[model samples]
Target chain A: MAQQEFDTTAFRNALGSFTTGVTIITATAPDGTPVGLTANSFNSVSLDPPMVLWSLAKTSLSVEAFNEAKHWNVHVLSQEQQDLSNTFASRGENKFAGIDLEEGLSDAPLIPDCSARFQCRNMVTHDGGDHLIYIGEVLNFDQQDLPPLVFQQGQYAMTARKPWEGVELSSEPKAPECSYNEDLLGYLLGRSHFQMLFRMRKVFDEQAHEDSHFFALSVLNIQANLSLEEINDYIEYTGHSLTDTDIEFLISQELIEKLDDETYQLTANGRETSLLHIAQAKAIEEELIRDLGQGDVMALKLLLKRLISKTDPGLPDLWKAKETAK
Target chain B: MAQQEFDTTAFRNALGSFTTGVTIITATAPDGTPVGLTANSFNSVSLDPPMVLWSLAKTSLSVEAFNEAKHWNVHVLSQEQQDLSNTFASRGENKFAGIDLEEGLSDAPLIPDCSARFQCRNMVTHDGGDHLIYIGEVLNFDQQDLPPLVFQQGQYAMTARKPWEGVELSSEPKAPECSYNEDLLGYLLGRSHFQMLFRMRKVFDEQAHEDSHFFALSVLNIQANLSLEEINDYIEYTGHSLTDTDIEFLISQELIEKLDDETYQLTANGRETSLLHIAQAKAIEEELIRDLGQGDVMALKLLLKRLISKTDPGLPDLWKAKETAK
Candidate 1:
C-alpha cells in the first residue's frame, strides 16, 4: 500500500467498479457565462434537508466558475442523451449550444428531457484532495419516466433490475444434481423465445397457418418475390423450412402467390397477415414493458441484440442484403 | 418550491432516479466494536490524490462510531452480495456474525468477495445539513472481475453495458416502413435463441439427431418414464413435439426404450447422448460468457428468466411435477 506501489491506472479502474448515473451539472457564472460539465459522482446525501452532492476535479477549466456560482442544476441524463454527455464531458466549445434550456428556479441553465432535475443552491464546499466536493441544498426537483443512462467500468450501460423476491419459473427448488436445470442460459433463451411465439401461435393457429408460413410471410413482407430457396435461407435457422405443399397451401389461401421466374411474393392478403403478426408482436412487447418497466425491457433488448451479433453464425442480413440490392 | 410543497417522498423518488452501485462502509470503534451499514452514496472524487467520499445521516446509530473512527473501508458489493447488503441494511444484532473478515492495512474490517475494496484514512469531514460527509484518502485498494450490484429507482439491479458504438443487428438501418424490422423484442429473442441453437446444431447433427429429439431427450433427462403425451406437455412450448414415428426412431437408435405402460425412458445410450448435449450446451454458454463478459451474460440470463416467468403459459415443470409425485 505504499505510494510508489499506487498504480494510478489500476486505482482509477478499481474506482470505476462503482457504477453511476450520468449527470450534467450546469451553472451560470458571474458576468453571465453559462458553463456545464458531465459528472457521475452525483449522490443523494440528506433526505430531510433535501440535499445532494457531486465533485469536480480541482484542475477543471470551470472550477472558478463553479466555485463562484450561487446555484447549479444537476440533470440526470436519459438514455438518448449520450451525445449530450459526450459534448459536456469534453472541452467542447459551447457545450450548451444545441441543447434547449428549460427555465428553473435559479438562473442556472436547465436542460430539457433529463430523467431527473435538481435545482440546488450551492451550500458548502469541502476539500477532497485533488477534487472539490460541492454540497447543495435542493431548492426544487422533478423527475420523468425516462430511463436514466448508466456508466459502469468506464462504459455506458443500462440496468435490468432483479425483483427482491427473485424470479423462479417453478415454485420448487431444482435438484442440485440435475444438469438440465432451469439456470442454463441456452435453455432460458429457448424457453423465453418459444413461450413468446407460443402466445402468438394462437393468433396464427386461428387462421390455420403454421409457423413456417408465418416466417415466410414475414420475410416476404420486407423483401418481396423470394424463391422458396431464398426464403428458406432466412427462416431455416428456426429449424423449419417451407415446402412446396406449404406454398400451395399459402397460395390456395390467397396469402401468397407465385411470381414469374419461379419466385413467390406476398399478396395483399399475405401482407395484411404479416402486419397483423407484427401488431401482435408489438402488443406483446408493450405488455412486457408495462410489466417489467421500460428500462428493464430496453436493457433486455440491448443485451439480446449484442448476444445475437456475438453468436450470429454468418446469417444473411435480412434487411441490408435485400434493401441495398434494390 | 415552497417549504410546504417539498414532498419528502416525491423528493426521495426523484433522487432515486439516479442509479448507483451498492456499497458497505465498515469501520471499527475505538472500544473494539466493528460497525458497518449498507450505502449507495459512495463515489470517487480524485484519481491523482486517491480520494473518495460517502455520507451518513447524523441520526444513524453508527454515525457517531463512524465520526470517531480514524480509518474505514469501502466495499463495492458484487451481484452475489445482495444478501450481505440486506444484512447490513437491517438493524440486525451481530451484523458480522458468521461472516469472515479479512485483514487490511488499518483496524477497519475488510470484507471479502466484493467487486472492489478501498481501505482509506478518514481525512476530512463536512456538515451536509442533516448528514455528515466523510472524505477519505484511499490508502490501498483491489478489485475483482465480479459483476457489481446496482441500485436504481429503489430496486436492486444488474447492468448490461452498451458498447460505445451501439449494437446493431444489421449493418444498415432498416427501412422505416418495414414492420418486420429487427427492433421487435420477439424477433430479437427468436433470432438470438435460433442462432445459439444453430451453433449447437453442429454437435447434435453429428449424431444424426434433430432438435426435436434433442428437446425430447432433454426432458427425459430430467423426468424419466414419461409418456409421449406427458413429455409433449413439457416441451410443446418449443413448437416441436416428439411424434410417434420420432419416438419409434429414438427406440430404434437405442436412445430411448418403451415401457410396459406406454411410457418411455432414456436408455444408457440415450442418457449419454443427453449428457453430451448438456455439455455442449454448457460449452456454448461458456463461450458466450467469454465474449459478452460475465456481467452482461448474467444480466441477460436474469432478464430472460424474468421474462420466462412472466410469460409462462402453464408449461408443466419438467423437474418438480414428476419428482414430487415420485
Candidate 2:
C-alpha cells in the first residue's frame, strides 16, 4: 500500500472522510487491571449470530490484554460522553480513573451512560496489517435513547436525521419557479423565528408591551442602569430601537424608572415583567427540546450561534457588559 | 454467543446505535462482471500500511465474486449519493446497470462524486462466524469537498461538524445563574432572525417601507388582488399586521393600486420592490453559505424548518394560497 509516490497525509485525509460513531472498547487484563481505548472502527457483523467486530493497533498497550481476554465490552458512546471518549483515546496511565462501570455479562469492563452496550465473547482474532481485528459474539446487550457521538474527518460531529421522505416546510409543493420558495434559508429562518416569537407575544401582550419594549426590558433586566443610547446600541442590530416615547411608555407603566436624565433602570415591576417574558421564552424552548430531541436542539442552537457569529455586527454583548462593569 | 433467551431484535437495535458513513464496496467478478453492495461496515484498519477492511456476509450473492477478486474499490458516499447507496444495497441483477464508472488503477468499478474513494489490493481474508472480513491495502485514494452521508438507527442522516472549541455567541462568560442564559433557543432564534432581517432593512428604509408594508406587497406580488383583510391574515403570524393606513400609504406611493373597494394589488413598482427585497435576502443567504459552508447552512435550514413545523401557529400558507386559487 505504501508506494514511493504515496502521500501519507492525503491518504489519511481520504480515510477520515468515512464518518463513524465514537466507541470505547474495554477489557480486563490478566492482572485484573481495566484497560480501554477509544475507537471508531467498531461495526456490526451479523444479526443471526449477534456478532460484532472492532480493530486495535498492535502497538497499543491494551492490545495484549484484548487479545488474551475472553470477553470485552463495547460502549457506543452518547453525545454526553465526548469527554470520556477523549480520556480513553489517549494512552494515559489510568484511562478509567475515577469512573464507575456497570457489571456486564463478563469480566470485561462496562462503561455506563453509553448510547448502547454490547457484552461480547471473543470469537476470533485475525491479522489486519498493523492492527488486529477482534470478532466477537454478543451474549447480552442493552441500549438507551441517548444520541450517539459522531466522528468524521478527525473531528467530532453530530448528526441531524433526515426523515425518510425528507423535511419540507410547506405541505404543498414548493413555491413556483422564479419566486421565493420554502427552501430559501432566509425565509425558513425568519418564519421559524417569528412563529416562535408569536407564542411569547402572548406574554408581552399581557401587559400591553410591544416588541421594542420587550427588548429594552430584557436588556435592563440583565445589565441594569443603562442610558437610552447604550441600551439602543445593544439592540439596534435587531432593526428595533427604543425610542424616547417607548422609554416613556415603560415609565408610565411603572415597568421601568428613570435613574437620571439620561439613564433608566427596570423597576421591580419591570424586572418581574422581563423575567416573565424570559420564563415564557424558556418554556417555549423546553417544548422545543421535547419536540426535537435534545441532540437536535443542541445542534440547532450550535448552528444558530455559528450563523450569528459569522454574521454578527458590532453589537455590544449585554451579559459581557455586565461582567465588565462588575 | 446467541443464547436461547437472547432477543435478536433488541441486539440488532443496539448495534444500529453506532452511526456510520455509507459506502459501496465494488469488485470485478471472475467473469469480469462488476459486483457491488452498499455497506456501512467499511473502516480504516491501519495508517502505516494504509489498510482498510469491510465485512460481507457469506450468504451474499456476490460473496464468491468478492472472495476471488484480487482488487476492489470503496466509495465513501456523499449526501447526494443516497439513491445510489440504496440501489446497490438490494440484490438485484445488473446492479451497475447504465452506470458510468471512472477509470481507476484497479479493475473494480469506480464510482464518481463520492465524498472519498479508495482503490485497494486484497491483503487478507479472515473468517468470523457468519461473515468474512476483507482487509485491503490502499494503493490509491482521493477525496472531494462534499459532505458525507451518515447512517444511524436505521435512518439516513447528515452530520454537522462540531468545532473544536464549540460555538458561543458571547466571548464573555455565560449569563449568571437565576437569569436567562444565552443557551435559550428562542432568544437565539429571535436574535439571529432579526440580525439577518436588519441587513434587508437598508433596502426597505430606502423605499421608506415598513416591515408590514413589505409583507403586504410580497403577499400581493404572489397572490394578486388580495383584500386588506386577506393580506393581514397571512402576515399576522409574523406579529405584524397591515393597517388600512399602511395599505393607503403603499397606494399613495404608487407601489400598489386599488382593484376594488376592498381589494389591492401590487403595481409594477411594488412587485419590483418585493423582488428586490427577496433578491437581497437570497444574497445574504448566499454570503452565509460561503461563510458557514453549504452543508452547515443546509443543516441550519433543516433544523429551523423542523422547529417551525413543531411551533407553527397555523399561519396561512402564502405559496399554497395561489395554487388553491388556481
TM-score, chain A, candidate 2: 0.93
lDDT of each: 0.91, 0.86
Just chain B of model 2: what TM-score?
A: 0.91
CAPRI-style docking class of model 1 based on DockQ = high
* lDDT of candidate 1 over A1-326, digit per residue (tens): 45636789999899899999999999998979899999999999998788999999999999999999999999999998999999999997888887778888989999999999999999888887788889999999989999999999999999999998998876677756448888888899999999999989988998898889989999998788788999999999988899999999999999999987788998998889899999999899999999888999999999999999899888888886565353
Whose DockQ is greatest here?
Answer: 1
User: Which pairs clash in model 1?
Assistant: none
Candidate 1 lDDT score at position A173: 78
In order of appearance, the predictions have TM-scores of: 0.97, 0.93
Count: clashes, candidate 1: 0
Q: Where does candidate 2 stray beyond 4 Å?
A: A1-4, A175-178, A260-262, A323-326, B1-4, B176-178, B252-254, B260-262, B321-326
